[model samples]
Target: MGEIYVDGARCQGHARCWALAPETFEIDEEGYGKVIPGRENSGDELNVRKAIRNCPERAILERSDDEAPAKNEEVATS
Candidate 1:
């Protein structure tokens, strides 16, 4: 599982992260970023990276375990 974190103070209710990866994140009714329960450490590299890149506030962060990070594999451009 990959670790993901949301800096609540930095979130601006943009919901970009949710839009990018609905399976991984959601915006609360109060307009702050919240990680969907049990998704904090999901190994969905593609979706997680997409959310991080799409978040306008840059509030999202990822952490990998002690193991070496994954090598870059080609992903098709949308």
Candidate 2:
């Protein structure tokens, strides 16, 4: 399975990630990105990667299999 992470401090609230994958990402009350739970991986690896790449601030992050967690991030959404 895969995991989603976001660097809230780096997030500019551009909403690009949310726009690309509404089912997986949303804007929190504070305007930060909030990822939907239980659907982090869900086999939508390509879409997840797209969302990550689409992040304007490059705040979106992904971890798969045995890969180490990316740097300077948190589980802001999931």
Candidate 3:
């Protein structure tokens, strides 16, 4: 299985992640993005991919369970 993460440093509150996957992503008070707990693996790979690809900041990422730690400064996961 794969996991989704939101890079806090890279997130610019563009909301592309939330727009593409509302159930998986959310915008915080500061307008930055956060991954909704337990929603990252909602089995909606297509939308997740869309969120990842559409992020202007490239903040959304998908990593396989066995993959090494993500490169983001801060990784938010469900």
Summarize candidate 2's per-residue lDDT along 1-78 as a digit string, tens digits: 457767687898888878887778878877789677766664356676788878889897666545645443456544
Compared with the true structure, model 3 gives a TM-score of 0.70
lDDT of 2: 0.72
Weakest 10 consecutive residues of candidate 1 by summed lDDT: 68-77
**Residue 41's C-alpha lDDT in candidate 2?**
61
In candidate 3, what are the lDDT values of residues 1-78, reduced to their tens digit? 356788787888889888888878888898888889877565357887788878999877666655635545345542
Order of models, best lDDT first? 3, 1, 2
**TM, every model:** 0.69, 0.65, 0.70
What C-alpha lDDT values do all the predictions have?
A: 0.75, 0.72, 0.76
Please list the residue runs of candidate 3 whose C-alpha ends up more than 4 Å from where it truly belongs after superposition. 63-78
Model 3 deviation from the true structure expressed as Cα RMSD, one decimal place? 7.0
| Global fold similarity of model 2 (TM-score) | 0.65
- lDDT by residue for model 1 over 1-78, one digit each (tens)? 456778787899988888878888888888778789778876366887888888888888665454323433223332
RMSD of 1: 10.5
